[model samples]
Target: MHAAEGLITGLCALACVTPARAGNAVQAMPVDAFLDTLAVNTHVNYTDGAYANVRNVGDDLAWLGIRYVRDASPGSGAAPLSSYVYLAQRGVKFNFLMHENITQSIEEVTRLNTAVPGSVAAVEGFNEINNWPVSYHGLTGIAAGLAAQREVYTRIHDTQGFAGVPVYDLTGFEPKQVESRVNSADYANQHVYPQNGEQPTYEANGDTWMGNAINGLKKYQLPLVITEFGYFSSPQAGWYMLGVDEPTQAKGVLNGYMDAAAAGVKRTYVYELLDEKPDPQNKNDGMHYGLFRNDNSPKLVAYAIRNLTTILNTSTVQRTRVAATGALTYTLSGMPVSANSLLLRKKDGRFVLVLWNETRIWDRAKGTPLSSPPAEVEVDFGTTASRVDLYDPNVSEAPIASHRDVRKISVSVPDHPLLLEVTPGAPPRL
Candidate 1:
C-alpha cells in the first residue's frame, strides 16, 4: 500500500498506552528551550485581503507560510510588498512553499530576492505529494515525483538570487516517499495531520501518527519544518473527516504545538489562519480547518493559539519538580488525573508554569468530546513567590486571578491548559 494509505489505515489501530494509575507523578520530561518557534500558514493571494487579521495575530507569530507563485508580485517593483513590510516591521519571517512550475519558481525567487532581499527565509518544493489534488503535480508516480523535486532543488540552489537561502524538498504526506526524494536540500519538510476522527494528544511514547512522522524525519538529520498541521471543527458532522467541536479544536491546536516543540522540530506552521468559505459541505470544501471563521471572527482555537504563543514563547524553559507539603490531587470526568506542568522562564525574568490535564478524552468515531472536569491542584514553588497570576486559554480575560506573596498556590487545573505566571524567583535552580 502507498505510505499515505498505510498511515490512514494503520494509525488508528496503533495501540495507545493504557491510562496510568490516576494520581500525581512528577513528569520527568525535560522542557524545550526555544523561543520564536511558533508560525502560522497564510496564503500569498490572501495577504492583501486578510491584512487586518494578519496584523492582529502577526505580532505573536514568528513565521508566515506562503506559496511562491510565478507572476504573483508580493510587492510592486523595487519596494517590498506591504504585507511583507508589515510582517518585517513586526519581526516576523516568511517562507515560501513552491507550487508553480520550476521555471517560474526560479524567476519568482530571483524577483523576490531582488525586490525584498532577506525577506523570504526558506523556499519549499511542492506540498503534500502523497495526497490527492495536491499530489497531482503532473507527475504520474513516485519516480516522477522524485525527479521533479530534484530538478526544482537543483534549479533553486543554482539561482544566484537565492544564494544564501535554504531550499527545502517537497513536503509529502508519506514519510518514506519524502525521505527517498530528499537530496542536498538545506532542510527537510513534512505535513503531519494526526487527527483520526478525534482530538489527538501528544503521546510521549512516540506511537501516535505525529510521533511516527517526527521519528521518520529524524533519520535525515536535517532541520524539520511541519508546514501544515491542524484540526477541523464543524457544528454538524460528516462535512469534515475528523470533525471536532470548538473546544476539541482548541485543545488539538495547543497539543499539536506542544508536541512539535517537545519533539524538537525546528518550526511548525498551523495549516491556516482563516476559513476558505463560510461553511464547508464536505471534506473537499476546505472551509472548516481555519483558526478563524469565514466571517473574520476569532474561533475558540484562534484564542487558544494566541494564548499559547503569548505564554510559551519564552527564551528559556526549565523543568522543575513541584514541591508540595501535602498531597495535591485532581480528577478528569470523575477519574483521577495527573496534571502535566512545564516551567518556562521568559527573557524578561518572568516565570510561567503551564499546566494541563494529561488525559486524552476525545474520540470522534465514538462521539466523545474533550472532558473538562475541574480539579484543584496545589503546588509549592521551591521558593517564595512575590506574586502569582492565572491565565486560562479558554477564557477571554486578563489573568483569571491574581495573588500576592504566596509560597504555594492552589490552581484549579481543567482539561484545557492553564498558565500560572509567578514572580521570577523561588523555583529550584535548573
Candidate 2:
C-alpha cells in the first residue's frame, strides 16, 4: 500500500477537489523561509570536475551532502579528508553520511570535526538500509535495519568529538515501512521520489504524494529532511521510469522543491550536481540524474534552479495578499485555466510577484515538449510603482521593463515561471 493512503483519506474527510481548482482559496506562505529549505545533493571529489560544478551551484545549495569517507577505497590514498577541508575553506558546509564500517565511520567523523571544528552540519547514520550494499548493516528487514541504526546512532553520539553535532536516522527508501523507526535519532531522514510522471500540485491544504510521506512521519514529531529527491532524464532497465526531457526535469525539480517546503520539511536535497557516466552497452542505465550534463555544461533545469534561488534567496520575504481578478487569472490557449502565484514583500520593502501557468508543458504519450501561445496576466500592485521588471526563467538575460508609475501591469505569461519586481516608490538600487 502507498504511504499516501492515510493522507488521501484525511484530505477526503475535509473535501474533495479537482486539480485546477484545488488551491484557489489557499493563502500564500513566506517565500524566503521556503527558499531557506532548499538544498542540492552533490558528490565533490575536488580532483575531478565535480568541484567546479559544485561551486557553480553552491550559491543556491544550503549545504552539501557527501559520504562520510570518500567513495574510493581506503588504500587509494585519495585523501578524502583533505577534500572536505577544501570545501570548508571554500565556505561550503556539509551533512556527511556514515555508510561504511562502524569503527571507520566513527574515526572519520572524529577526524572531520578535528580538522574543521563544527564544520559538519549533521551526520546521518546510514543510507537506504532497506536496500543492500548501500545498507551498512546489510539488513533487509525493517526491524533489523532499525536496530543496526540505533547502535550506530548511539556510537556516534557517544564518541568523544561529536557531542553537539546532530545525528540523523538512516534514510529509508520506503516511508511507511520505516516511519515508526524514525525516532531513534535526532532528526528524521527519508528519500522520496514522486516519479509517477505527474506535475507536483497540492490540495486546498498543501499536500502531494511527497507531502503525504512527510505527513506520515509527522507522528514522530521530529524535524524532517529529504536527503535525496529528483528525476532522471533516461530510463534504466530494472528501475521504474521517471525520465523526462531536460525542460520537464527542470519543472519537476522546481515543483518538488516548492511542495517539500510547503510541507514544512527542514531541508531538501536534489539527487546530484553532475550527470554520471552512462553504461556503454545500455544508454539508459539510470546514471543521468544531474543538473549538469556529464560534460560539465549547464542544462535548462540548471538555469531554472539558479534563477529561482537567485530571485528567492537574495531577499527576506513575507507572505502578502493579492486581489486575483483581471491581472492574475491566466488561461492557456487550449489547456487548463489556472494561475499559480506567490506574492512576497522583500526586506527592502519592494514587492515581488511570481507567476506561472498550471497547464501541462510536456506530453508524456508523445515524449515531447508541449507548446502554447503566451497568456496575458495582469496584477494590481496596490500602489503606483517607480519601476516594474519582468524576468523569464527560460532566458538568462536581464529583465524587460513593464511600466512606470502604474499600480497595475499586464504582461504575457509563458508555461515557464516568470519573476516580477515592483518597487513601491522611486526605483531602489539594484
Q: List model 1 lDDT by residue over 1-430, tens digit each.
A: 0122323222322221222234443232222343444567765345343434546545324322222211123432232356555655555556765554567656655665565666667777665565533333565655455666677778777777677777766654455544443564666766666544433434322336665566666667787767677776763333224556778778777766655655566677776766655554655425677777766677888777655555544433643334332122222222233344444555445566666664554654564575655667776654477677898866743578998887667777776668777663444568
Deviation (Å) of 346 in candidate 1: 1.6
Ten-residue stretch with the least lDDT total in model 1: 63-72
lDDT, candidate 2, at 60: 30
Error of 1 at 375 (Å): 6.3
In order, candidate lDDTs are 0.56, 0.56
lDDT (tens digit, per residue) of candidate 2 on 1-430: 0121112112212111222231233333455556656666666543454444444444334322222221221112244566566655555556766655667766775776678777666777666654543432455555556766787778877787777767677654455555465436887876666543444443223334465556566767788887777766663222224467787778777766655654567777777666755343546524567777777677777787767656654542532233222122222122233335555545444555666553454555665656666667656544466667787755653565566787667777666567777655532357
Identify the runs in model 2 with alpha carbons over 4 angstroms from their true place: 1-35, 45-79, 133-140, 156-164, 177-183, 202-208, 235-240, 278-282, 312-339, 343-347, 372-378, 411-414, 425-430
Using all chains and alpha carbons, the TM-scores for the candidates as numbered come to 0.71, 0.71
